[model samples]
Target chain A: MSILVIAEHDNKELNPATLKTLTAAQAMGDDIHVLVAGEGCAAVADQVAKAAGVAKVLCADHAAYGHQLAENISALVVSLAKDYSHVVAPATTTGKNFMPRVAVLLDVAQVSDIISVESADTFRRPIYAGNAIATVKSDESIKVITVRATAFDAVAAEGGSASVDALDAVFESDKVRYVAEQVAASERPDLSSARVVISGGRGMQNGENFALLEKVADKLGAAIGASRAAVDAGFVPNDMQVGQTGKIVAPELYIAVGISGAIQHLAGMKDSKVIVAINKDEEAPIFQVADYGLVADLFDALPELENALS
Target chain B: MKILVAVKRVIDYNVKVRVKADQSDVDLSNVKMALNPFCEIAVEEAVRLKEKGTAEEVVVVSIGPKACQEQIRTALALGADRGIHIETDTMPDSLAVAKLLHKVVDEEQPQLVILGKQAIDSDNNQTGQMLSALTDMPQGTFASEVQVDGDKVNVTREVDGGLQTIELTLPAIVTTDLRLNEPRYASLPNIMKAKRKPLDVKTPESLGVELGSKVSVLKVEAPAERSAGVKVADIAELVDKLKNEAKVL
Candidate 1:
């Protein structure tokens, strides 16, 4: 039984989460192949071919897959489903959008966001905001899964000599038309791939105060993130949210400023290597998960921390 | 003019869940249950569409044990017109559920179908997309805002980067995101009116669909606990600790 892993890229660079998915795929019987589905993604496909465990790369270059639309990619993936025993992708927004359609097109079920693969047929996933973990066994002939990228360590991106193939299929969903996407621009590293992250919560009060975090994040070369409360308060964009329903990140260091960590927020970043929480409220739940807790006003702590770091 | 919304009953968000002694599943023997938060948002969106005169009827559906009717009724109390309950003991995976929903779609001929992105129990996040595939309809998942126009529906989705807007043909599928709408609490009078609303019950077999879980629960366990460390009195010590003790800096 072999595995076909889906690759995620921004036309120019690959999302590190795809490599983590590759790591998970390598563990599940290793005739591991990858799919780079996009317009002009030949370079991305070449990059995927160099991943240490990959055996082959399939680059599906078509206009319909330019935005990595689910409607287009689902058909392309489903078209190739019959040849493999397992299909895996990282549990990102793009993968989550398409894999379900592939499973239904193949008349199979999807096992989503598994943290661990107990066996080829069995997996473990978090439920109820990580309060409990469920070990599930699949009965389907062809297994469809989305791996939680935070749970698996990425394999080295080099040291392989796999061949790349072009898929000549024009998969399109005619009823839906993609218009435009507004991506937030920042000079700092991406939240998912960054080694250090600094997050703010509701106590930041408003968007203006986030500048404090910007300075500190700049000093540390860290990415900026926000709790759900901060996003809900209109202090940050939803993309900056770090919680159960938001981006799950596991950086080398996570600094939470004024964030009263909800269980959902904790679920996303609790896996970080070292967590530091700064909140005036001593009883804040964030302290429980923080390796270092500071009970002080963030207004005072932010500038002082910035000064101290500089 | 008809909108169909899918609701799911899950462990109450407030209750601290406990792992069963046998590790079969979470101990749900006598725990309080509520409508999944995301589903509540779905119901709210459907009701708002009706209230705005964009939809003539709002129908809520739940696929689960008989107790799931409570969730359907909650949707009714929140302004849905009627309810449909797909009764089953064994929960079906997203594909089977989508197949069953596809059958319902064929019979009901609704103009729109709305569902929560995923359920809290299994968290598959696949059913709405699967239903759209099985039914040959366009879909918009993780929608934060929805606007319906004649022959078309504009969906603004909360994508990973920021926002992505897409236009889908009418009679489409949309899965709700948390920021879509604020679900209202059922008032006393509305709750009373909901009890009298029509609620039809059927089974997967009755609908001519075979439903079963493709993924079986092998075990359940509590996650590893995060051990707490010491608190810092000031920023200087915190920076000192990060530079030397943790070595992350």
Candidate 2:
């Protein structure tokens, strides 16, 4: 049976995460269709039509799905679930919010944040904050999955000319209303998709100290992130937190500053291609994961690194 | 308004879980288990709502072995009014868990259902949303802040890019995020008080729910390890290697 991928996008622009999810879809089978559900998101549908390996794009444009909220989006996906054997999305917050409802309505189990697709029915996923990997098999007829973007290489966006189809569905979320979105206003690339990530932990001491990392990040065109402890200590906003409970990122270069990495913190960024840990403690767990570990006070190393990079 | 919170018993967040030699599952034979961290946040939120008069009553529930009552009691000690234990030895799939919770929701008729977004163990992150689907309630997942009015609940969610706020009509579901609140410890007096709180044990059968596993564990193994590497002498050496060798700079 064919697969349907729920495209992850905010009305204006398509998120790169959709490409990563499509990469996983390509591995599963060739008959892949992407469903772009949003209000006035024809642009997103157009982008999906260009994603490599997809057969078609399903654009479900309606006022009811203005924000891709769970209530209506789940209904739209459920309506389209009949034609496909598998429905998948990038394991972002948007996917996590709605996929379970689709699984439940379809009488199937949702295999979430799958790192690899062993077979059509079998999958590998990390459990307990990446300490152990569990290979799970679904017995349900229709498989619902959320793909961890970092596990798969993103497919080229300009390589295919898949046809776009408009799917109309009567869907509305009666019980939930959009309030307000407070996005962290930043010019830097998104942490999850960035090529470089310069992260600071609690030892950065305060919010002002993050400026040091920001300087280095600016030189490298990298995104700024924080450990859970740094976020908890109010050294940065919660959105910047990188850990098991926060965003999982696998940038090409991950520079961990003053972060004595807890296993929870390691779970998020350990998959980076090259890791550099800068901490005063030689015994920091962050060092263990780092390809290059620097043992010195962050106050001393921060400036020198910033100067060297600049 | 009444708030119903679901707590799950999982391997304590601090424990270093080890995979078994046979590759079946993690060795939980004698590992210390506790209430899931997110569930604790859920319980803490429910208790805070009760304390602030936003919720008139707080009820805590768990679906697991009888030992899960210990987690429920912990929730009660933190401040739930009562506990409901859906006692079972094996964990039913998320759908089954939602079905069982559906029965309790029908009986209790609470205005709000607060649950952990996912347990650290198994981490399917589906039960609350599934319950919302089966029960026909709007859900706010990964919620960091929840503010309740007469019939409206505004939840500030921790989304991918930043925070998104959504207002859910009453009788909605909210799954807790880590930053919602720091859960308070159960003091000795409160722990003793929780022992006297009403604790009702029920079964999935009693709720007329068919609990079955739709997913099977094929195998389990340790994740690929990243061994410790060499320590650089200074910032100069680090930059030299990053540019000349690894070339990520």
Candidate 3:
């Protein structure tokens, strides 16, 4: 059985999450084909060719694919779905946006945000905001899944040639049209792809205090995150929020500052390998899951921590 | 323009869900149920569109057990004109739900369809997209802002990285995000009047749609409990442990 992985990338660089998807793809079997669809993603196709265990790379470069609109991508994926037994993509916004369409077109139920591979057609996914996990078995002919990228290791990039094939599928536009995109500009790693993340909570007080998190994140080379309370309070953008309603992150190290850990927030990041929490409240819920807890004001603690690291 | 808003019944968000001892599913013996919070936002958005004179009719629909009609009445209480309950005991898979919705769309032909991004109970954010694909219509998922202009609708979606704006023609599907709008509580008069609103109930057989299960649950288990860690006395010791012992920083 072969697995088809859709590569996530801009025209310039392949997202690191794509490699993680390859890891899950490899677990299914050795014959893994990566499909790179974009306006001008020949370089991305070349990069995927170097990834280990990749049998082939299919490149579908067309103007309609520049923004990866759900309509066009779903059409392309539906055409490609005929040749593969399993189709996989990282459970990022892009993958979640389009995979369901592919599943409906193919008449299969899409397995979403899977955290573990039980078997070829079985998987484990979080339910009730990660309060519980449900093991599911697919009864359909074709298995469509979106893997949680952080749960798997990224396949190593080694020199190899994956035969590139150009798919000849007609582009059909839907009612949706891409108007514009404004990507958040950050020097730190992207949260979804980052192995280490540092998040702030309401304990930080306001948006200006987020700079403290940026400094510590710079020291550890980690991505900055926030709790739902912080995001709701306007201390950070909603994209930076991590919780049941926000992004689910499982990094190597997760440091939470000034955040009282609510159950919803814990559901998102409790799976991190190492957790450290700094909160003035002694009974904050975050301390329950933290491997290291510090009961102190983040205002005084942040500078000291940064200086010590420096 | 006429609008259709879909809602789901789920465990109230405030209640903590416990896994059954057998691990087959959650223990829902006597737990209170409420309208899915996100779906309430969807209903509120549709009602607001009508109140703002952009929509002439707002119809709500829910596909679940007969008891789900309570949620439909709640939607009506929130200003929805009417409701259609596709009664079923089993939770249909996303593809099946989309198919049933497609049948409804064929019959109703509403100008727009809005739904919660995903149900809190299943947390599968697929029905909206699947419905869009099945109908070959445009979809704006996880929308934070929506503006209607003549024949086109502009939506700002809440994506992981940031926000993205997409423009789609009418007769499209739009799933609401957290920031889309604050759902309003039903007033006393509206709650009393909701008892009089028209509600049509039909079974899966009556709808002539096959409710098939594509994926089956094998087991359910609670997440591993995280043990509490040591609390450092001060910043000096905390920094020392992080750098010297933990070696993460």
Candidate 4:
């Protein structure tokens, strides 16, 4: 049976998470279809058509889909769900918002944030904030799942010659209205997808000290992250938080400066290929997980590390 | 206007979860349990709405075994007007929970329904969205800020990049995020008074909702632990180890 991969994009561009989701879809089966629902997203549809392993691209263009409203998008996905054996979406904020609705309307269960595909019906996921991993099996005929993009390697984006087909389904919701958005713009790569990530914690003391991490991040061309304590202390915004409840990242190289490594914070980044912990406290829990531990005062180490990089 | 808030009792966040030797599930034999933190935030938001005169009454509900009534009473002590306990032996999946809540929403007919974005134990951020689907109501999830006007509510959501504000019509659902508000502790006087508040109990069979689960757990296991590594003497040695040994530089 064919699988449907819901493309995650923002009208003009496709999110890299969708590529990772496609990788999971490929593991389930070979026949895969990509659905791009947005306003004036013909370009995104064309991009999906070129993605490797995509058999076809279904484009739903309408003003209502521009924001990817759950009420409207779920209805549309439900409309097309019967023809496919499986429906998969990236576990982004957008996917988490709407995928459950799709599961319920289809009278099935959604396997949220599956890190591995043990089988078509069985999968592995984190529970209790990643403390334990559970393998779950679904008996429903149509399997609905949300993929943790960081766990899967993304497929090639430009290799296939799949056909792009337009879908004329309109679901305009009157119960909700879009107001405004405030997205943090940065020159650094996205925190989740970046190869190298540098993070701080409460030991950074205040918001101003985050600048020191930024200087190091600039030198390494890495994304900046923070612990929940740092965010709670108002040293940074909530979006920069890295923990069990926040965004999860599994980068190639992860550097923790002044972070004591609470269990929740460790759950988010412990999967990194290589980890470096720099803290003044010798008994910090982060040192237990670090491949290379450096006991140092970050105030003295940041400038020296940046200079050495040059 | 009346507001409905849902709470859950789960293993305390401070507790380190351990998988059973048989791989059935996480061991919960004698661990301390508390109100789910995000649900506490939802209860706080509802109580605050009533305190601000935007809501006339705040009703708190919980679904689980009889022990969950303790959480409901805690919500009442925190300033909820009444409490409802939907008793069951095992925890239901998110869909079944949503179905049960849909029946409660039908009975209460509140103008607003508030719940935590996700439970700390299951960590499946699904019930609120599922309930919204069943009730056909607009949903504002991961809400950091909620402001109820005359006929509409504006919710500021914590999205991936930053924040996004959306306005929903009356009779909507808002899920509380971490930054929603700091939940308050129950005062001594309120704790004594809450014992006298109205409390009701019902079952899923009485509500005409089936408790059958479509998903089954195969096994539960601990994640692979990372072995401790070497500690460098200085920054230069750390750089050399990264470039030469780890090759991650």
Candidate 5:
């Protein structure tokens, strides 16, 4: 049986998470193909072609596929469903948004936010804000899944050449249309792709205080993140939020600042390889899971920490 | 306009969940159950719309065990006019939940359906979108703001980048985010009044739908524990330790 992966990327560059999904797909026995569906997305197709273990690249280029609308993408995926036994995508906003639609269209169930592949049908995923892990097995003939990119290694892009093929599937545009898009321009790495992340919580107090985190993050070449409390307190944008309601991230190093480790917040970043908590509250719950704990006023320690990094 | 709100019963957010020793599932023995936080927001949003005289009726639906009727009653106390509980012992897959809700939507004939972005229990943010696709209804997910006009709804959604505003016609699905609104607690008087409110309980089998299992649980396990680090005495020592010992900097 063959596996099909949906490649995520901007038109100019492929997201590294695509390779992680490829690694998961490789575990299903390596007869894999990647689908790069977008308008004028040949560059993404080309990038997918160079990824290891990719047997072929199916490019669906059309004006209707520009926005990667769930409706159209679901239709395309359903059309491709018959050819593959398994389908995988990185559990990003885009993947999560569309994979369920495809699942419904194909009359199958989707395993969302899978952390590990137990078998062809069974998988491991977090439940109750990462407080519990559930291993699920699907009995359906076609397995649709969204893989957590952080749990798997990204496949190397060397020693393989993938043949590119143009999909002839017709687009079925629906009510959803492409709207104006806005992207945050940050010097730090993207939060989902970052191996290291330093997040500030309400402990930082104000937006300007986040500069302390920026300094430490810059020194480590890490992404800057925030707790929902910090975002709700207007200390940072919602995009920086790392929690159950926000983005679930798993970086190599996760440093939580001034943030009381709420269960919801821990549910998101607790999967990080190394956790460091710098909160003055000695009884803060974050310390329970933190590898490194410091009971200090973040305001006082932040400047000193920044200077030390310099 | 008729509005539909989907609710879920989950362990109270404040309660610390414990995994069973066998790694099969979480221990729910004496844990207090409450309506999901996001679902509370969704119900509150619907209630506000009805309070403004914009919505003709607010119908709350939940798909879970028979005990979920308590969550529906909770929603009734919060101001929903009626409740529909698709009783089942096991939690169905997201697609199955959406299908069951679609069946309810077809019967209720509501113009709008609002749901929590994801249930706190499964953390699978799929039901709302799946329902939208199943019913071919337009969806506005992770909505922070929702405004209903004559036949269209303007929704401000929370995206990774920032807030995104979208407009969709009637018969749409909207999922709530955390900052949508502060949910009000049910007063004692309201709780008494909710007892008199009508709550209809029906089995999925009675609805002529076979709740099929999609995914099966193999095991449950606690995440790996992190080793505790040393607590330094001062900033100078902390910095020196971080630089020379920890080597993170």
Candidate 6:
């Protein structure tokens, strides 16, 4: 069976999640084709052609797709969905925005975020805020699925020589207009893809205290994350939240500082290979799941940890 | 302008969800239930619009078994003008739910529709987008801020990296994010007043929408437990354990 993966990328570079999605798609089928739909995205098409396990890359470069509007992207995917047995995309905000539209147009129930591909139709996903795992099977002609990138390892970025083809399709809608975007600038790695992630919580007290995390993150070459409590308390922006309702990360090492591990917070980072918790409250639930538990005040621990790392 | 806000009754956010031993689904027997958090934000946003005089009426809708009416009443207590309970025995898939909402949208013709970005139970962030597709309307999902002008609405969305502001024409769909606004608690007197609010109960057949699920759950089980490991007395030992034992450093 042939599969079509909607590549997540800007015109400049492909999202690392796309590589993980490609790996998930490869597990489901051999004949996998990548669709790079964006304005002036030929570079992304060229990059996907070399990604391992891809058979072909279809580049649909158009001004209408530059912003990845849901109305336009859904129409584009629906138009070409007739040729594939399965359609997949990474479960990023962009993919979540458009994939459901594709499902409704196709009159099928789209699988939200599958973590494992049991087969072409059956897959495993988390539900109830990652407290439960549900194995689901789809009975539709074309299975529409979103892959949780953290659950799958990324495929090799190179070693394939798939042919790149231009796809002439444009669907523009006048109902929506892009105004502006304020992307958070960070010198550290992206949290979702970083190997090491250090997060703060309510115990960080205020936003200014995040500098302590920044110092430690700089030493570890890691990404900075925060719990929902910290974000809700305005200690950090919403983008930094790692929880059931926020971004999910499964890094090689996750250090949760002064965070009372709520279940929602645990849902996001419990998959990390190594978990370390530092909290003043000895009774904090975070210590229950932590691989290394250190009960201490973050203010004192932060300085000590920074010096130790140095 | 009239606004439509969709809400869902999910297990209370504070409750620890447990998987059933039979593996059929999550065990919700005698568990506390409340309005889904994101949907509460949607309701709050709509109520705020009405309070700001941008919206004349705010109508809330919920689809589920009769038990979901509790959530509808909760929304009414929070200042929704009316409530619509689409009664059904089984939980339909996201697409089916969207189609039902589409039928309501056709009947009500509200100028704007707001819903939660995702339900806490299924965590399927699809219904609002699917409803937007079925109605051929624009959507602003994961909205942190929403401002309604004469014929347009500016939605600041919380995306992957940061925030994006998109303008959609009237009659658009919006799904709320966490930072949209802090939802307020309903007062006791307001709760009593909500009991008198007009709540219409309708069936899927009444809307002429056939509801069925295309996906079936093969099994449901608890996530693999991560047992606690060694405790470190100090920062030095913690760093040593990471570099030597776990080797993640």
All models: lDDT?
0.91, 0.91, 0.89, 0.94, 0.85, 0.94
lDDT of 1 by residue, B77-100 (tens): 999999999999966777878988
Positional deviation of residue B76's Cα in model 3 after best superposition, in angstroms: 1.2
- From the highest DockQ down, the ranking of the candidates is 6, 4, 2, 3, 1, 5
Using Cα atoms with residue i matched to residue i, what is each candidate's TM-score against the true structure? 0.98, 0.99, 0.98, 0.99, 0.95, 0.99
The residue-by-residue lDDT of candidate 2 on B104-150, one tens digit each, is 99999999999999999988899999999999988999999999988
lDDT string, candidate 6, B202-236, tens digits:
99999998988879999999999999997899998
Candidate 4, residues A62-154: lDDT per residue as tens digits? 999998889999999999999888899999999999999999999887889999988888889999999999999988888899999999999
TM-score of chain B of each: 0.98, 0.97, 0.98, 0.99, 0.97, 0.98
Shift in Å, residue A85, candidate 4: 1.3
Clashing pairs in 1: none
Off by over 4 Å in 5: B234-248
lDDT of 1: 0.91
Model 2, residue pairs in steric clash: none
Give model 6's DockQ, 2 decimals. Answer: 0.90
- Measured against the true chain A, the candidates' chain A TM-scores are 0.98, 0.98, 0.97, 0.99, 0.97, 0.99
Off by over 4 Å in 6: none
* Fnat of all models, as shown: 0.90, 0.94, 0.87, 0.85, 0.61, 0.93
Which lDDT tens digits does candidate 3 get at residues A19-134?
Answer: 98898887777789998989888999999999988999999998788888899998898888888889999888889899999999998999998888878888999988888899
- Cα error, residue B138 of model 1, in Å, equals 0.8
Instruction: Note the residue pairs that clash in candidate 6.
Output: none
- lDDT digits (tens) for residues B1-249 of candidate 5: 899999999999889889999887899889999999999999999999999999989999998988889999999999898888888998887888988998998999899999998888888889988998899988888888888888888887776656667677788899998888988989999989988988888888877778877677888888766556666666677666655766655
Q: Write down the TM-score of model 2's second chain.
A: 0.97
- On TM-score, the candidate that comes out on top is 4
Error of model 3, residue B246, in angstroms: 2.5
Model 3 chain A worst lDDT window (10 residues): A167-176
lDDT of 6 by residue, A226-256 (tens): 9999998988888999999889999999999
